[model samples]
Target: MCGVLPIRKFILLFTIAFMFHVSLAQEGEVASLSQNNLQTYIVYVHKPEGLHSMQSESLHRWYQSLLPVTTASTEHQQQRLLYSYRHVVTGFAARLTGEEVKAMEKKEEVLSMGLHPEKGFWKKSNFDKGVIIGVMDTGVLPDHPSFRDEGMSPPPDRWKGRCDFKQTANRTFVCNKKIIGARSFQVYDNLLHSFSAQPVDEIGHGTHTASTAAGNFVRGANLYNNANGTASGVAPHAHFAIYQVCSLDECSSTDVLAGFDAAVEDGVDVISISMTSLNVGQLFEDSIALAAFSAMQRGIFVVCSAGNSGPSSNSAYNAAPWILTVGASTIDRNIIATARLGNGDEFDGESIFPPNSTKRLNSKLFPLVQPGINGQMLSQNCNNGSLKDINVKGKAVFCERGMEVSRLDQGKVVKAAGGAAMLLVNQEQKGFTTYTDPHVLPASHLSSAAGLNIR
Candidate 1:
């Protein structure tokens, strides 16, 4: 007792059901999803237990069934697989950009003489006159008093020129009334891109190094201290130029090579590089090395650091036969101590006997004590006696080496106790060495005797 359905109605119902089934199948095939149109998501499938029983094609089919149709394109599927495999194998979210990795590697190459005796001896020679010391670190600070001259402004002029290599109109030039010439080579976007036109240093390392190499001795300039500083460069008053080859993060081999080429073209006298790297294979094609060789062929001296990994047998860059590799040493003779007091605190010792009621907190004190001043106290305080007596919590702590604990570890303990700054008194053995640790706030080292007097 059913009425006969129309042929057209039956056909329409069949088509609608077929379309719905197709849509469902397509939805199930998408491999991934992305929020931004420009960005693509990558998906990795987990391996099933005892999956060795399955063939490669069977495994791929199993993964494909979990994705949507839109994401089943060969390219997208490949990307997902690669991303997943890499993540699982490495167990890291993302790797450091090439530039950042390179910068860290170069730090080991940039050696400091610290406070070595031979540091002064190098100044006696005129070798730096024709040498070109390329500081491939931070941007140089143009306003630093160390760089100021008579009738010279603190912040110098900025260089003007295009730096993009892909552009035909690109011309690299830097101008500071004193900066005769400059050339920029921006090749790699990840590492070698120049950020500014001014040849000023954004980081202090470049300034310190440049000053160490060729900065003139200014009469009233406060080099390290406000006193009439006289720590002249190895070759002060020498004509020099800068090759801005480094930034805050990384420097590329390509940029370095271009800078070397420019220095060679300019006929630089000597090349000083404060950078090192573990990629020995890159040295052969390294622009710096090529430039060093070309300069050497023309009788230019190439000097570099022996690296900070001291006591280790690894040979640092520029330690090769063709280059001069310098090491670090201690320079300050006396022991020194620096202490910081809380809001209401005072410090007293045999050499430094301030009244207990004296406002020691909120005060920065550095005492340089000599031998025989507080003979017994100095000997007893060699380890942690001086620091232990200071009640350093919410204050500053200064300790000398020779303690049972590592200097770095001791500094950490002081930091944990709410100390502001931790100064390490140099041990008698190394003489003068630079201490650089990213942890434990701003820190410096003083001589042993100086530290005792400060307490």
Candidate 2:
């Protein structure tokens, strides 16, 4: 991953969030409605700057009339307008049916409209000075040496945000020269209450992504004696602010919008979010997309992840074309591991073991076995109860991927079963693509072809 992302290449005219697919709010507008039946869409109302609020309301009313707002909504709540963009693009994002979108499109005030999101790509570039990237993710671990502000200049004078400025575990986290601001949101759907927490990250995901974006340089960085090198963010000299939008599974729309709102208000030049919703479309009704559009109007670059559901067709989220959606690509790096079977067949794979772990294993081989349920090959599941009755003592048991459980849990189950090591096999659909994950025991994972060949 590149260390820091540059905030250049912003378009000035179009209020942009790349369009993805068509929406069907009800049976009449299209054959079938999508999973989200909210009749919601981002309405791109075309108008010049400086229009009166009354004119904007007229446009909003015309759009909202297509589908009557649910009564559960208050007079204020019924105005389910997430963003009213007036600068870069003169439009409002709202819940509109397919017929509404079509009818709204016919209006002279509307520009363009369509489905959800698209794709993101990254290229190698040298870091430039004076960029303040806003990172909206899990949260940052302020104490990691990588975040030190030594030898760095003061934060850019334009920054106007505050530290979440709370104390936790008797430690107070305030912004320094590197991390210019910190905040957290607990909103659920823009109607939730507020709470505070420390900025120190309990989960490493936020720190990892933040560091990759603009972390300070740290020497001797490695993954357990692997990929040894100096560590730094994509734009090492760039200042950054943190908006902790998630402590739960992914980020709720309310929280994500709160993060974007704060970032734009704080004069952030760019926003990078590594969150997405599964089975959700690219409707302006989506909190993140709507907030991103507003940020775009203010000339802030927005970058997001394309998600890890790849190696399968149509498995990507955040495919919005206007937003920069990025995907992970492999480098030349690979962990050195081998799967040697009892039949003298040896195949190569990857592992999370340190560079010197082979010396500890001593090139030893143990009885390799694949445990399954009911002789149906499902025994290799390796989940908690999937192996309780199996005799895995002192043997190297092979586990199968998928079943919606954590990969590390499989290794833990093997270790708890008195097994010496764990051999994980990928599902049939997953190919040579592999990720190095932690394990409770000495373990490695094989590709579908490799594991099947071994079997």
Candidate 3:
């Protein structure tokens, strides 16, 4: 994590949410849809001033009233309304037909509507005190040392969020003043469920982003004696309200909106999100954009990722003008390792795989083989089942990076195939850029040019 300057002014950052796989309804195109086609649509309504003063139940009722009534069973009607947006916007996400949507649009209170899609450094005294940054991603590990509340003040009295994490027998995830609030919005997804009933970060993404945003100072922070130093977030004193919206596979648009509703209602100072869908539609057609606009209106800042389909023309996502779109870039620091060939040629590379303190690779030379050279499909990617026929026993297997295969998976494949080590070559599109990854075996990620030379 790079050291970021302390946030002197109240600059809010926003994150784009969800990996939307469903096709989106284009603007003014809903009228052509079949009248009976029932799909989830995000409806935005004009919020009357002083609506916040109303009771929560009353607000929910107001949103419920906007939903078209049906003669079906009460349970069926209740299921139509997926989520209500009180904080992020005055709206609701519901299952509506084309005719029903057209009817809703005619209402005077209806402002706009859209389709639903499915998915930093320390500063002690300058530490952003009292600022609450709402993280919308995977759930967090509340017990991480980065979120310790030492020298941190309690959240301000206006904070209405609560910790929803429950203790389990194996581990106890506790929350303090630093990690003020934690909640999960995985109730909408019927296919994939949250790893736990609580808002525990099953994946490390939430913990990583949370720490990077406002983690506390921890000494000797390093991964296997590399990048060793004191680690702290950009704003050590800022409070975090984690809203877990993603499951293992994808983030549901309904669940994400619920999270946004809660985060905005929680009175967070900033909204930071790192997830993005493969496709981002027009401004009004995207739920994230609509919700972000509401957050901006409420004086909250939003920040988002520029997506991973980069190094390609027009590959950037989350390019909305209202939110800050951040892209990945190289920094000065790198984890140095080397890929030395049997031919006495050496290529300096990067890897996070820790070397044994007593062992060195220079003493021995293993046969270097490329799995796909013998004409096996996907062997270059080192995908599972692709190396079954390849005999890489006690040899250093060279693999290509990409093809929707992760670097970790590639190393795992090599390790499983009885390979001694792995040499990961970046695809041509990646050019000179290389990334360090924690592999299951000894591995080095070499740039595209070096990989070509080795080949």
Candidate 4:
């Protein structure tokens, strides 16, 4: 069977070693080995209910008897058991070979075998009043008005988390009824970074994500005089337990696992992680995946961001069937900014910045320039190296999307080049998805066809 498959990919998969976990549940899932080729896996045994201590011990004894330790690839190193899941699933997690999987399937206690995803998700909640939500992200801005818990009672008695105040902006980590807990982690002991010692959210990413998930409502909410109005989280009444596991956009797997370890021990209901990588490693070593399995055992829902690498094949991250992945979208609401070309042609673009500081979106028109008109290679992408030669002073610089060119960073680079405004063109893959970012100067994102017509 293996010889009949696509030779290269199949061999690569076996060489790298994929992961799979067997469950005795009635439900079944089919997995494709086409995408993942990582070593190390987590094996799960179904936990049958109504079992006393002795009966549970018997199940464990029977499963452990099947795990025959083999010599690992590393010289003189034997196969090792990484983690034990006794509370949620009665099993041991380890790295096993294909032969081991066949042996496992033959065992009388094993029901079925399939590749389990490291990712997980849930949907359609009954909106339980003020349910606890644990947010594991960059870090939370505890003092931000979005976290204010007004007219709320005390923390749930089951909450066992504590707050950390070191190096915070307010010199203390504030937690009220809505925000039940605040904690930070930095497992990179040997790395060199200023905030390596404490949990402080200097970058506002954590604040934005946490608030968007579970922050309470705040009146007169506006950032830079835009999106001005009342702001509220998707779950306004939901209580939050904030875990800061990332610093400066570098999320450590060890730190993420530590957060999950605490979230489970402290009894969190739901976990919201807005971070995921394009490539996932082995499940046994995958910090988030391993954590999600344990959380699922305890009936916890895990939600994650699907990443912006979409519109391309395999550009998606967090593809593990267990984790719920979310893609961003635009509503029917459109704020029109008319970009009238010099040749009497006009194209509508999407933008959030005003013509001036106190103005609305697309308040006025400015002279637009294509950076490549001066014969600059890679200039249209607006990367750092190409900005010096182009004279974008007092003019809107046109930029194309892709090639490690962050959608938001294009505006920043154009502004730094003394450009008065920006007209960003999207690639065809993006289609009609027009996204607007806060620009240092007035900037708008247009569709690929709109950009071609403008040029």
- The model with the greatest lDDT is 3
Q: Which digits, one per residue and each the tens of the lDDT, describe model 2 over residues 1-455?
A: 43432211111111111211222233223323433444445556544455355566665554444333342244633655555665566565665555545665676666676544321121123343567888877788887877888656777788888887566687767677888788877433233555455455676777888887777889998877877898776677677788887764456665666788889999989898777754444454356666777788889988877666655998655666657876665766787567777677777777776656556664677887789845745457887776778899998988888666788888888888899888888888888866687567778788999888977
- Cα displacement (Å) at residue 103, model 2: 73
TM-score of each: 0.46, 0.64, 0.64, 0.60
Clashes of each: 36, 18, 15, 5
Q: List the global CA lDDT of all models.
A: 0.45, 0.67, 0.76, 0.65
Q: Which model, 2 or 4, shows the larger TM-score?
A: 2
lDDT preference between candidates 3 and 4, better one: 3
- Stretches off by above 4 angstroms in model 1 are 1-135, 151-178, 186-188, 191-194, 221-228, 281-287, 333-335, 338-455
lDDT (10s digit) by residue, model 1, range 368-415? 222223454442323334444444555445556555766566556565
Query: Candidate 3: minimum summed lDDT over ten consecutive residues — where?
Result: 5-14
Which runs of model 4 end up more than 4 angstroms from their true locations?
Answer: 1-128, 166-170, 187-198, 277-285, 312-316, 319-322, 342-344, 355-371, 374-420, 427-433
lDDT of 4 by residue, 135-184 (tens): 87766767788878885557788889886655545466656787788787
Please identify which of the two predictions, 1 or 3, would achieve the higher lDDT against the true structure: 3
Consecutive 10-residue window with the lowest summed lDDT within model 1 = 9-18
